[model samples]
Target: MKLTDDHLQTFVEQGFVIVEDFYPEERRAQIAEGIRQTLPPWEVIADDPPARRLLTDDFPYADMLFNEFILDWDLIAFVQRVLDTEDIFFRYAHNWARYPDPGAEQPGLHIDNGNNSLLPPTSDRRYGQISTWYFPEAVDENQAPMQIVPKPYGQDLSKRVLLTVPAGTIMIFNTHLWHSATVFKGREGQRYSATRIYGRAD
Candidate 1:
């Protein structure tokens, strides 16, 4: 799981890096299906703030995925190698759900974090936030992948960067940075992805 030198460079220059093989296809499918079972039916509030969920229960594969990603061998190594911190505080995360296209977009654009309170936004950096942008199914131009303003937390935010590497590859990114996944355009089946926020420690 440890990132190679190439991975480190990409993370620094771009402000984010995508690591593959975080979960095998078989495991990814199993975990995605299990998490979906815990979500409410996708038929309400599509016009409002959109429907979202908070994980209050203990599920099997969901927990398994959490363990495998949150401070997994590779994640831990990444934290130590990149941030030079022995440990990172992972702030509690809320589970999220998105239906097909034409839904709400309030939580749209902008990083996973905000700072209307902190004068200089210093408090916002206490915890490093991250999420595994899990794609239960295949993603394409139509499916809409997550748009990450790579390094937006500290660099230029003039334009956003987006990419579709592969399914099951965990996108470990800063929650304090601005990002949003595109909405699916199809009219039938829905795209499913759950973000489990991980707050890096100090």
Candidate 2:
């Protein structure tokens, strides 16, 4: 679906906006399964601590389903609206699965600039890069919810947003936003999400 003025306003104020059910469940399921299958065998990773992170590099190139999803016109248009540009370049993509790891330390909040972009980040939304995360299944608090700090709130712990959303949920945010991936607290269940990043062509 196209983004509305309210979405723009929210992005301007909070540095991000979450779009629920951006894609159909069936489509998301296919993408999720593709990613899962691309990963190493669960039994192998389950015993290897480092393998539990399950982050893939250049994942879109590994499968046609991922390539199509990244190139979908509707998704591009939605991101265009957020960046206020007609042309944008796909930066990169990766899929990740977070499993329960009570020993895992809380990740630090950081921006996706520097490494994701060649230029320095700007406060202006129009010139900022856009990053999105698509969750194929519901993400509850115990399943490692994403943590975001709104623009106005800065680093205030009280103002942080814990993204506990339903399946097919997509969160679009400025790459300059301060956000972090929380540890999975649940005893069972995995948190799988695909990420895509884009930047203004100019």
Candidate 3:
């Protein structure tokens, strides 16, 4: 679906926006199943207080369902509009599943473009890349939600946006924005999300 004016303004002001119901229920279910099939077995970290499992570097390129979702015309259009460029290319993609862990320390707030940033951290929105986090399953506050500081980079966390969205939601944010993931504390099941990064095609 196309972005509304409010959605665009939110992204410009807060550095991120969530597109609700971006994917249909059937498509979301298919993607979730494809990921479950493609991912390697879970490897839990023993030393961690709450058991944590991580799966990385395995993208389901062969999955036609995932391919269709990623190349969605509306998604591409949104990225192009945000970057103010017609040429946009995929930079990276990955999926993560966080199992429930009591007192587990989620990743600290950080910018994705730090150190590897192509433009100065203070550059305008068009200079940096956009990253998307897609949830194939419904996500709640206790299920390792993403926390984003709404202010510009380096600002204090007076205001924050916690991503507690339904299944098939897509959250897009500027690479330079400060954000972090929370620990999973739900009663059942792990938190699953697939993310893809895109940059201006130079």
Candidate 4:
């Protein structure tokens, strides 16, 4: 979906914007099912080193389901507008399953710039990278919503924005934004999300 003036302003001020109702429930389910089919059981991955390595080292784009979802024209156009560039390239894709862990604590907030680029962020955001996470499952407060600190807020924990949205929500954020994953407090099902990263060609 195209970003409106308000959405663009939010991204400019907060460094991130959540786009919802863009992908239909059916399409989201299809892409999610593909990921779940390939994903090994969490227990199996924990116990098997080879299984874990294979998953961590592999990219999900090999599957056409994921490819179509991430390569959709509308999504790319939206990203291009945000980066203000027609030259953009796909960086990577990964799927994550967040399950309930009894004593696990939320990790520290950090920018994606560390692994995405060597140079620091620019004032013009010309070299900025985009990290888009498509959530197939509706996220609730207790279901481990992503915590993001607005660009102007620095590392203040109290100023964090919790992303609690419906299914089929795609959140696009600049890589320089500080964010962290909170622990899953729900006792039942796990939360599923897939991320696709993109960077400017120049």
Candidate 5:
């Protein structure tokens, strides 16, 4: 779906926006299945403490489904508008699955750039990077939905957005936004999501 001006404004003001039904249900299912089948071969990156698994490294580039999804024209156009540049390039991609770990602590909210940030958060122009997260299945609060402070980094947490979206929903956010993932408390299954990072080609 094409992004409206309001959507762009929201991203600028709130530092993030969710686009529902970004992918069709059948297509989401196919992507979900592909992730499930493909993730098994990768070694568990962190299983002892948090039950984290990564389908990253060489896998994202090598996997046909992931490669296609990253280069989708619509997605690229959206990112281009946000960054105000046509010179966009894929930075990284990862499929993460986290199981319920009651004792595990939820991560603190923080911006993605950290020590590598080139510009301050108050800047009007976009810099650094942006990311898109795709949820193949519907996600509720129990499934560890991402919590984003509505304001830019270092601002007071006056408002927050908890992303409880339907299957095929994609959330795109500025890397400078303060955000963190809620702990998984659901009993049913793992919280599955695929993430792709993009930046100016230069």
Candidate 6:
């Protein structure tokens, strides 16, 4: 679906947008599979809980190790649309895989840097690199889904917190926002999500 001005406003004010089915289901499967192939068996799934990993590791530990999702024309089209640009490049990305497991607690609300415990930002910074995650599985509310605190430090931020829609839903959020995935029951199920970064052309 094309992004409307309202969508952009929501993102700027709330820090994220959950666009339903941004990609066709068939294509989403391919992207998900590509990410699955590169994962270690140990990191694959957890019936008791799920698994989480940052592909940015030095030695390297991402599922696909590349933008497999970018290759899909339809998917890229949507990405371009959301970005409101005629052209875009597929830069860096990360992946997350949550399996249907017991004792799964949703991820806590934290910014990207905060989630990873990166160096604190300077006071003048209003935004950071934008990141997007396309979840390919079905996510129900009870799953804890992904909760976000809109524009963490933005003027519009109300301290009003909210949860993102489940799997197969795509979310584009400002890195400055505090967000996290709340793990819930899905022991036998798998939640696969990937992020793609976009930037201006040189």
On TM-score, the candidate that comes out on top is 2
* Alpha-carbon RMSD, each predicted model: 5.1, 2.0, 3.4, 3.2, 3.7, 5.6
The residue ranges of model 6 lying beyond 4 angstroms of the native Cα positions read 36-68, 71-91, 104-107, 114-126, 142-144, 152-167, 199-202
Model 5 ranges with Cα > 4 A deviation: 40-62, 114-122, 152-155
- Candidate 6: tens digits of C-alpha lDDT, residues 159-197: 645444544678876565666666546434445566665
lDDT of each residue in 71-180, candidate 3, tens digit only = 76777788888889999887777777776665677678888875445666655888778888998888888888888887454546557788888888989988788888
Ranking by TM-score: 2, 4, 3, 5, 1, 6
lDDT of 2 by residue, 59-114 (tens): 54668888777887777787788778898999988877777776688889888877
Q: Any runs in candidate 2 off by more than 4 Å, and if so which?
A: 40-44
Q: Per-residue lDDT for 69-105 in model 4, tens only?
A: 6687777776787888999888887887766554566
Question: Considering only N, C-alpha and C atoms within 3 Å, which residue pairs clash in candidate 3?
Answer: none
Consecutive 10-residue window with the lowest summed lDDT within model 3: 40-49
Residue 72, candidate 3: alpha-carbon lDDT: 69
Q: What is the TM-score of each candidate against the true structure?
A: 0.68, 0.90, 0.84, 0.86, 0.83, 0.63
Q: Write down the lDDT of every candidate, Cα atoms only.
A: 0.55, 0.80, 0.75, 0.75, 0.73, 0.55
- Candidate 6, after superposition: displacement of residue 48 in Å? 10
Q: How close is candidate 6 to the true structure, as a TM-score?
A: 0.63
**lDDT sort, best first:** 2, 4, 3, 5, 6, 1
Model 4 scores a TM of 0.86
Per lDDT, the best of the predicted structures is 2
* Tens-digit lDDT track of model 1 for 1-202: 4578888777666556777666667878786666566654344434443433222232223556545444466665675555556665544443445456644343467654442111232323334554546565555655556677866445344567665656666666655566766765543344555444444455
